[model samples]
Structures are given as structure tokens and as C-alpha cells.
Target: MSEVIANMSMSLDGFVADTNDGIEQVFGWYGSGDVAVPTAVEWATFRTSEASAGVLRHGLATIGALIGGRRLFDLASGWNGQHPMGVPVFIVTHQEPTDWAHPEAPFTFVTDGIESAVAKAKAAAGDKNVAVASPTVVQQCLDAGLLDAVQVDLVPVLLGQGIPFFGELAKGPVQLDGPTVVEGQGVTHLTYRVRR
Candidate 1:
């Protein structure tokens, strides 16, 4: 069975990005250590603590597809058509981008909604997990009762104000199960299963 998981690196203040939508403060751990974690793309590689490297390796091996919002897709410039995971990507948007450069890439622009995107991503993922990479999409999945787990790479920082990893949920409070914790150098990886 495929699970929809929301994954993000967030600050102590619950912000994933800075006030200007910059992730430099929160994403420092990606290059703050000595261990090298290579991805499918040649241009992007992570240098992190050995513990973090193990987590990254596991994610790269297990996650078979990705779901993201248009904002994040634009922020990363579509990851140059190849995400680090090298899996298929499903973008949830009201309308597809007209100037998308990589039509041949395994990227699907889902214009219907989040549910449709999740369905498509699950199909693409087969038996593996589908990772939701955007905060808005994560919130939507939570609201729709479509998410299975939440993975937070908790960083030690307080942005005071910024783009949060979670916003107001339409469905209000959502319960979660045990958070299996893994302590890293500058981050603590926490994985919680969504309780049904």
C-alpha cells in the first residue's frame, strides 16, 4: 500500500521558510556536515551529519513519487525537471503552467485538485510512499484526511515569522501517533503516523 507523507524541515517556530520565502536559514543542515548524500540529480547533493545522511538515504530509497504546490514548484524552478529523488512529480494547481520547459520529464501538472494529485502520485509510486513537498498541499491532505504520516526535520532556530509548515486546517485538530525520533547534528527527524 502507498502512503501519503508530508515532509519538511521546519524551525523551532514552525516556519519552513523565512519572511521572504527564503529557506537558507532552515535548509542549512543540508550542507552543514561532512557526510555526502547524493541524489538522482547531479547538481544537487546533501552534505550532512551521518545520522541525517542515513535518513536521507532511506527517503531517497523509499519515496517513489512527489506532490507539490505551484508556489514551491515555481520556487524551485521545477527542480530543473529532475527532482533529487528522480521519481515522478505531481503538481497541484488550478491551471498548468504554459511555459513549462520540460515536457518530457516525468512531471504531471494536475489541474483538478489535491485528491486527484494524490491519486495520480500513488499510482505512480506503486508500492512505495508518495511524499508531499509543499506546505499548502500538506495542509490540504490533512484537511481531506488523505495523509498517512508527517515527517519533520526539526531545526534549532526561531524565525519569529515566516512561511509555516502548517496553516489553519479546515478540519481542525488532527491526531497523530508515535513520533519515532532520530537525532541528527543540527536537526531532529521526527516521524508521526496520522491516526485514523
Candidate 2:
């Protein structure tokens, strides 16, 4: 079975976006000093047209499947429907949609539930990791006791209010198997292997 990895960038004060975050602004491809360090955000804001390219490269190469929510899908569609990850992808939504699948990279839409999504992603991933890229889906995975590990990169900026990773945990109780923390480039990256 493949590991369900929920990885997301959160504000230091804990907010994925403002309450009224328009789809255009929420899934920001570039760092706007919102969910990134000041130095990187500044550099990207000033120059570097491909600032987010590095982050995408690092994230996509590490996972075999990408899972996300409806809002995330809508936001990402603005990127010219480019499925940059180039792997099997799953979206947990009430509504059904389409992915402009390439002959080489085909996208799979899983709507039955989170479990179905996980199973399909695992099958698609083989031995690689299945990543839950959406914050909402990550929280649901936790609630459903489906996640095996969580990787959180705590940025320096503070949104104070917006979407959160943990909304209503319903898996009774969850324990973490020690956290590995690393402070680099002004952000603290924390990884916790889930001990369910």
C-alpha cells in the first residue's frame, strides 16, 4: 500500500487564505508574502518570473499522485489546465469534472469518497507516495484516519484567518511518531509520521 502523505504550507498564525479569498487569489501560483518567507517573496515579487517553478518542481517530483478539493481545482485551472505533476491525480468533490489528459499523462477523477481516491491513487502510484495536496482533503484524511504521514511547512507570514488544515478531526484520536523539524530559509518544515 502507498502512504497517504498530506503536505501543505500554512501560515505561522494558521490560515490558508482570507475568508473571502477569491479563487483567483487563494491558489496563488507565486509567493505574495502570504504563504512564503519574506526573502523569497520579495525576490519573486521583484523579479524571478518562475519563482513558484522551483516549489512545484520539488513538490511534483516527490509524489506520484496529487489530491485536492474543488476550489483548488478551479484555482489551478487558471494555469492553462497544465497538470504539471504529470502523475495520476484525484479530486474529492461533490461535483464531477474533466481533466485535459495528455496522451502521456492521464488524470483520474475520484468522486466516490476519500477512500476510493486513496485506493486508486495507491494503485496508480505503485510504490511511490500518494500525496494529498489540498488542505481540505488533508483534514478529511485525518478525520477519516486515512493519512499515514503529514508534512507541514510553517511559513513566517501570518494570515490570522482563512482556511485551516485541521477543521474537525473525527478519527477519535491521533498520535504522531516524533516530529522531525528543520529550520531553513526562514521557514520551519515539520514532518510527522502518523501513528494510528
Q: Which ranges in model 1 have alpha carbons more than 4 Å from their true place? A: none
lDDT of 1: 0.94
Candidate 1 local lDDT, residue 27: 94
Worst 10 residues of 2 by lDDT: 40-49
TM-score of each: 0.98, 0.74
Q: Number of the top candidate by lDDT? A: 1
lDDT of 1 at 127: 97
**lDDT per prediction?**
0.94, 0.65
Candidate 2 overall Cα lDDT vs. reference?
A: 0.65
- Runs in model 2 deviating more than 4 A are 22-60, 98-105
Candidate 1 contains a number of clashing pairs equal to 0
